[model samples]
Target chain A: MKPLMESERFVRLAAPILVGAFLIGGWELACRHWQVPVFLFPKPSDIARSLMNDAPTLLGALWVTMRITFQAFLCAVVLGTLIAFLFVQSRFLEISLFPYAVLLQVTPVVAVAPLIIILVKNTQAALTVCATLVALFPMISNTTIGLRSVDQGLANLFRMNRAGRTATLLRLRIPSALPFFFAGLRISSGLALIGAVVAEFVAGTGGRGSGLAYEILQSGFQLDIPRMFAALFLIAFAGVSLFLLMAWLSKLALGGWHESEVAREA
Target chain B: MLALNHEEAVTSHEATASPSRKPSIVDVLSANKIYADGTEALAPVDLSIAPGEFLTLIGPSGCGKSTLLKLVANLIDPTDGRLQWWRGGFDQVGGEGRRLAFVFQDATLMPWARISSNVSLPLDLAGVPSAQSKPRVAEALKRVGLEGFENRYPRQLSGGMRMRVSIARALVTNPDLLLMDEPFGALDEFTRNRLDSDLLALWWERKLTCVFVTHSIYEAVFLSTRVVVMAARPGRIYRVMEIDEPQPRGEAFRNSARFADLCRQLSAWLADASLPSPVRASP
Candidate 1:
């Protein structure tokens, strides 16, 4: 039998979407009927109208936030991959340096934001560094696990074939590390957006092309509740989109060789 | 087919009537293996494999058949004794020209690589350019009936197909000796039987020296020119049986009385191997 087409599959996939729509619709109707205060949870319709009204400003903030997030995410991925390679290659270094990585992960970006701004002397670089620090640990840990997670039997097979360390690392270990590396990437993408926003919030850039955080702060100060909700929606959308993009990239890279991707296809 | 023809022509030209002038001797002399926890994995053992011979070591689990294979492969050093290879009056423990490839019970394929690349691994390690290794990989895959699966990944293949890919990988190096440690043990019976027959056919065609370790008597008899029966409790050889059979052994041979006789002999030897040593039993 022929399989269901993409449209049909999407329709089948829309059950949760429809439920979510119904819930939002019900909330909007209840708020309007009860004349609830707009400051405390504006209606979806009101938010959508505010989004359209301030489209240019909101889009500009989104572009700024996205740029920071992308730059930071890229830095995190490169730095994390390098650290992971080091961690896998040397046990002494891993033991000594891993706790410092954990310190970076556990220390809130808010606490570090002012310090980073003071040290870097550039607002954009400070924000990027904050986001990178926040997003790097998962990649380091996951990629390290992936590198070390190769099958022992396969290692022996390579050894018996007289494969040198470089060949083993390049041909066997790196490919094995890809899935875990991407998994970490998916998680860190969202963290990067959150980190960018938090860093902007703490840094107090004073409206010099700040991100969604500044927009939200500006609307809160101006008592524009619907506009604030609109900015929040944009941030949420960006976070979800970045996460999905990473997920898609992972599937594309690993789908040809991994069982998880094959199951998704089925 | 072209490579097989070349190998056959070479073998026929070198096939002398007398056995005195064998091309080389791969020897394991009084080898001993002892684990750190005081477990003797393998006792003193002396064995020799002739060039172009197919030998199977049959025993129960933990009989050190695999240890013996690893010792020969130089993957692990024996606690005592020596392994020697003699080629043209020169003796060496291991050298560059002696390319030895090992296939494990697990397919042990690199999960990330395409089948063609995985099969090309040995040659890659040997510094053969990818261009030079491509045809050898294709021929190896063709020999193992995996011709159309060059682009597929290991995770995409069935268990049997993955094992075939491992076999293709072992053959891709064109090594003089192939060592397999229960390579088909994990496969289902039907797949195992089919792989056994395919392996025998490939062995006959390539004239490559093979040292296979298996737990199955029938499989050992069906594939080997000689069977080395190993006993446990500080593993040592119990018996060596030579099968006076020709190439392309089929299902018909498996059903024959002669095949049953060999299987029974190996089984009895294995049983004897498992029992406590009589020298240690006296009060």
Candidate 2:
């Protein structure tokens, strides 16, 4: 009932939807009124129409991309977390290897995607490796910092209780790292999509197993701009949805107590 | 590594009052803390906390009052001398089926956990399963006068409330000894005063042996059964004074002439403690 009234929650929900509708409606109207060429910049209506016309192929491409993204994101989260654990456990290991982690992050995935594709012998696996490299850095950086960020006082408290290493790691370190871990998830989700798309662009494979990037390349070659726009729309939509999903997951896990998740009373 | 059951804890408490029994819960035999860099944080300090005593350590910043508390809590190893916890025999802290708790200067609550979870942290660290520790957590919260706040997060509560939660966390294990490091130092004056009395009530009810560290002379005077004054240079004890005020110390006590006189004396001790060569100045 309170959400339905003049609260910030009401405004937060309505503002974005209303503004997006207005912008899209205006773009559609202007395109039609000005006799704009669809090739130059397709109207929202044309994009929507193309979406329906190419629904099956476009969605299949979307599924391929999503599958790669999921695989990469999962690998990044797991492998990155393990790396963070290693770093947390041993200062010597972290010092010896952190620079290399940074090197992997800074090197362009596009520059290495072709080599990976050549070496891996499987296009899907190659795309996943590239995407994982792109998504991996944030997870390592955030989780390591989070694991190291235990409150000094609380650390003392644990010591005073004579908590063993396993107890400290499982109970204290893991919970302390959750907020930071989820924050990394939000960033990595989008990077996963970007990485997969970039990898596909470099791979340029054109069988039925192609992802949205291949469809995009094909549409470009044929001058089918509307279909390209439709694919682009799907990618953008997917990224946004992934972000919202992670934000929701963060809220679900931490909303009861975390400062970032607890709803502001105002 | 082990904890006393409720019955065992009660029996221990009863035995504590026996004339034949030793009154000291902790004996700091000339304990000192020196960092890895050879900088001395505290000089050798000898002190003993008797059962059910409220002992406050008051000193200026950089004094080793907090260092002393940490030594007793066994959070850090002392550079010199022995620190012992009493459990029939003088033994190390944390493994004697003996319970003690420490409240840090900051609330030190896990921001991602509910108040109940924060309070149950010690029990969890001690490996007490949640099914068994839930009632103890609830009782601790009740003792802190925060009965319905078990579900709230640390951030949801105000500063004063957060301190109460910290105290509740300290109280959850039915600890025989409690160490507090300026627990109410961050609160507003009114809130501090309110919490001051609330803390006293809890102390009186629990009959806890508390070693509190604070910079405020008035706070040290009001809350303590004995106030130990410390001085910085190498962080040594300056003086120890007993405040013979009655239990459940309240507003009347706060406004009493005796309270003011004691505060003045403690303040003088602190003032002199901070001066360069207080003995030289006196001479």
lDDT of 2 by residue, A113-192 (tens): 98999999988999999999999999999999989989887887787777899988887899999999999999998899
lDDT of each residue in A2-24, candidate 1, tens digit only: 55445566676687788989999
Docking class of 1: medium
Give lDDT per model, in order.
0.84, 0.86
Per-residue CA lDDT of candidate 2, range B1-283, in tens?
Answer: 1254332233344443335544477888988988898878899999988877899988877678888888888777898898777654323334432367888889998887788888988888877888888988898888878999888778889999999999988888777788898898898999999888888888887777789998777888889999998888689999999988887788899899999999888878878888864443220
The lowest-lDDT stretch of 10 consecutive residues in candidate 1 chain A is A1-10
TM-score of chain A of each: 0.93, 0.97
Q: Against the true structure, whose lDDT is highest?
A: 2
**First chain of model 2: TM-score?**
0.97
* Sliding window of 10 residues with minimal summed lDDT for model 2 chain A: A1-10
TM-score, second chain, candidate 2: 0.88
